[model samples]
Target: MRGTIVTLGGGGFSMADTGITPIDELLLGLTGKRRPRVCFVGTASGDAASYRERFFDAFGARAHASALVLFGQATHAFTAPQILLEQDLVYVGGGSTANLLALWRLHGVPALLEQAAAGGTVLAGISAGMNCWYEGSSTDSFAPLAPLRDGLGWLPGSACPHYFAEPGRAERFGEWVADGTLPPGYAADDGVALVWRDGALAEVVSERPGGQAFAVTAAGETPLEVRLLARF
Candidate 1:
């Protein structure tokens, strides 16, 4: 079983549009299914109703859009595995990365998602969602930007999202890698994504002009040329 992981530094269906952005359009196309059923897991935001609404509003017109709310109230009936594995795409919403990981473990979401990925579901997400796929990441989920060592490890190495959106992200991440706190990994600017097929980076896509991705290691950060796509 092979799979693809789309890691976004920022930007996606949640960005709000009468139509989807190019980056999101690319993600939908990866499913290889017409009108694919896409499930939004909003555990990071504590199952925020507004976030769920955003998902439906963005994707409902094009796909069978739905959400899995693990807090406050239940919105979907199927079990985690059922919902995860049966879908064409499973998108994770961003919020608190630490909390997201903790909650996911509590509900066995990690295992279910791994199963979904192994079965060839297109797994994608932004921010914390992006951070979760790597062995570790540089995140602000704990207040300040810090090294988050615990991750699902679906992709090799580490990751850092919002590489350019946040000030000092590049500097701090470099320092972490230099000091051996975080492993060398990839990073992306807002509105950009790193696409991995079978655990190897296959492409870089961006919705905004000048949006970028990078390969950051102990030596230094090197910019990855990305193909920019026009907005819908």
Candidate 2:
């Protein structure tokens, strides 16, 4: 069976509104196997330690059947192919996207993730986690410090999280799109998520009332426009 991918905006844990229900539905849709195996990667924030607790708090007793695995260090060879082989979900955590990608690639985790996903492992991530799938991104959180780092490219374009919070971020995103430095993509606000399946956007969901998504593309030299996606 084909699996599902859930990418979250930054501040997933603190966000008052997290569209985790849709993610749950997607996971249930993927498999009916009891006690699904789940793995987490790249949490410099120390959030992975409480993943199961937080999930149970948010989802209640229904989360009991899920098994959570965490890979917290910056670079470590994930030696459990048995776990990878049997995992139903592989989740990446939020942190420095550059560092996460570097560590993941250095440890050859990305290729392993691809293999797992191709083999029907449900893939999900939040914040920097989500950013890992895109080719590149405009993130004040990490990009300014290390511009040369490449993302995992699980998807075909760029990803911009915290899309509306930062000043002039929209303008910067447009510039990158126009210059062909980044591909056409979606910008996600907190509490909102864009779901991509089989290399295509399947749907978007929002738990917060004010979040909006932007579709950006190059219009002309030194010009770009940000338009709201009607679907969201």
Candidate 3:
């Protein structure tokens, strides 16, 4: 069965009035007859406390009581996948994308994630959490460091979040897209969410101060033009 993938901006969750907190809507959309088994991965912060207080506050007792909150720094390589396999909603927390991806590769998490998705699990996350799914992504949040590897091949191209908010980010993204360094993909700002279902873009929604999503393709032989899509 095909599953849903929700990509959020840097902020963890958003409010419906503001239009940014699409998580609740995403959850509502995914829920059918049963509650999904949720799991959070890449909590290198070691504890839920290190994450944004809003997460715990928003999720509240629900998050505190989650069955598995895998702190990447503390677990062994072999233990992660077993827990991942049991989850129906796997929410990857934001951290160092390079480190997270490295550890995931080392521990066989990617294959497990793909397995989970194939089994109809919902894969969702914010910032690095979302960036890890696409091809090349800008690590501007953790800048002074170089860009890392192509993301888990769940999607065919690159993803740039907090795209228009950061200065020169859009320019850098344009350069990369034009240079053929990264594939045609998206650029999301604070409150917008880019959703993909059944291997195609199903929706792109805005909340609060909205941002843009671009589809950059090689128009001629070199330069890439950023093509925009309708808001979901």
Candidate 4:
């Protein structure tokens, strides 16, 4: 299906201390290709070279992995947007959400991403990466946990990541949704991901066995069923 986006709470292949996780396998499987072309967008982390290397190190063997650099090094002649449009999947790195949004717009990435999505390219990311796709999110991009309502809006409502790993995130997200600071939306624990397909919640998958995901509204929080990837 087109418009498939996987929003991970945290702990991606590069972010994790160990090897590839179930989340990684699950994402690659979505491409329905033997060796998918995956582009790592590290703009959120300011296009850090080490982060890019970590990405390739994690995925080099199984996929045609490449990183898109936006901090002055535009080595490829085709253009950054072209690089994204060509991928089977685009994985964004986590960092300051505010910076990510601004830079994406300037580079015309959001529009190209929409184009890529329309062509069946899957978009995925953790934390800030996840936060940027929704209408809004509770983020620490401002040096404090705050409400950021300016997002790509590819997916409706809001999103809250690191639900389990971050202390007080559950209460804060619930409060924001209830008090109208943010729209009703989904939340995910670290190592868990919410897969949105064709603009609706499609599946919830996790690397951790007991990891939780939630559907939070002005009314309250409802738990969503999570499928542990390792079991499958």
Candidate 5:
């Protein structure tokens, strides 16, 4: 089945107090449901209570929002995989990609996520969350913002989130792709979402002005057109 993935460099409810934004609005729209079942995967943030609160405050009033809290693997009626499968949309919160990867693997989440995507669940995230779907990405999970080459491989090539908002991200990602430490791939600036549909790039959208995107290769980097959301 055709599925969708929206990889945002940054922006969304995570950035604002009210958490309302065009990007998040678009996510809900993608689900094609009235008050779709939305799940917030905050594993990257260690299932922090504050982050969960923020997500609920932003989405609770609209969608059927819930946070799949995995901390300590607390006893619950449903397993992590089951909760993930039931969502119309899965929004991952940003945090340490390295830790997120490790924990997810331990809990058998990768396969379920793959299944969720194949089943037409709209998967989206920012920063570390965005980095999880690709084969590799530029990350701050380690010191010096290194290239993280081991990813889920759902999409081809590598990826780098927060390309403009963070210092040295562009430089390091460019270098890594050029030197073949990572494959030639895509990078998204703050407020930009590199959307992929059915395994190919569908469009590049931005929540604000001045946001850009790029296609990075060993030869060089090329600027990609970013469509500013009308509501923004």
Candidate 6:
């Protein structure tokens, strides 16, 4: 089945309260479902309560929004298959990619996510969430920028978020891909997302002017052509 996946390097509504994020609006549009149900999976960051509150303040009024908290008392039902598969969009938050993966596997969240994706549910996220879909990614999960090759493999290659925002991200990501520490992949700056449709890249989109995405390889890094979407 054809499915859509949007992986953002950073910049979205996840931690914002000032205004609705354009990138988030783009993700919601991809669902193409009325009053789409958007669920935030916050296993990362230890399901911090502040994260949940910010999420609701930003997304709750616009759509049927809920968050899946894995630690402490569960706010929403822990039924991954029923809840995740039923939603039009599943947005994962950024934090501790390693821990996120571990907990997800422990709770069978990965399988349910795969099922949801196969069913045409839009899967999208920023940072750690973005990293989970590829074969691998560069992350700070270990408190250092390191290559982690244990992705869910929903998409090919690797991913690196905060390409420019982080001091060593672009350089380290390039070195890893070049030396075979990690495979060739995509890197994105804050406010940009790499859009995939049916396992192929359809486009790169950005919320802010000058936000960019790139294709990194042993050869060198080349900018991925991107469209700057206008926000009303």
Candidate number achieving the greatest lDDT relative to the actual structure: 4
**Model 4 over residues 1-232: C-alpha lDDT tens digits?**
3589999998668557855778988889999999999999988888877787788898999899987777865533233666898999999989989999998899899988999999999999999999999999989898878889999898989999999788878888999999999999999999899999999888998888788999999999899999988833
The TM-score that candidate 5 achieves is 0.94
- For each candidate in turn, the TM-score is 0.94, 0.72, 0.76, 0.94, 0.94, 0.95
Candidates in order have lDDT scores of 0.86, 0.59, 0.60, 0.88, 0.87, 0.88
**List of clashing residue pairs for candidate 5:** 13-19
| TM-score attained by model 6 | 0.95
List runs of model 3 lying over 4 Å from the truth: 14-20, 33-35, 43-48, 52-54, 60-79, 218-232
Each prediction's number of clashing residue pairs? 0, 0, 4, 0, 1, 0
Question: Candidate 6 on 1-232: residue-level lDDT in tens?
Answer: 2588999999898645565698888988888876899988887778877777778888887889988877865554443445898889999999989899999988888888778888888999889999998999999999989999999888999999999999999999999999999999999999899999988999999988999899999998999999998885
All-Cα superposition RMSD per candidate: 1.9, 5.5, 5.3, 2.1, 2.0, 1.7
Worst 10 residues of 4 by lDDT: 72-81
Off by over 4 Å in 4: 73-79
Tens digit per residue, CA lDDT, model 2, 78-159: 3443455567776566667776666666666667777887788878777677778877876656546222227776676777
Please identify model 5 stretches exceeding 4 Å from their true place: 73-79
Q: What's the true lDDT of residue 71 in model 6?
A: 84
Residue 158, candidate 5: alpha-carbon lDDT: 93
As a whole number from 0 to 100, the lDDT of residue 56 in candidate 1 is 84
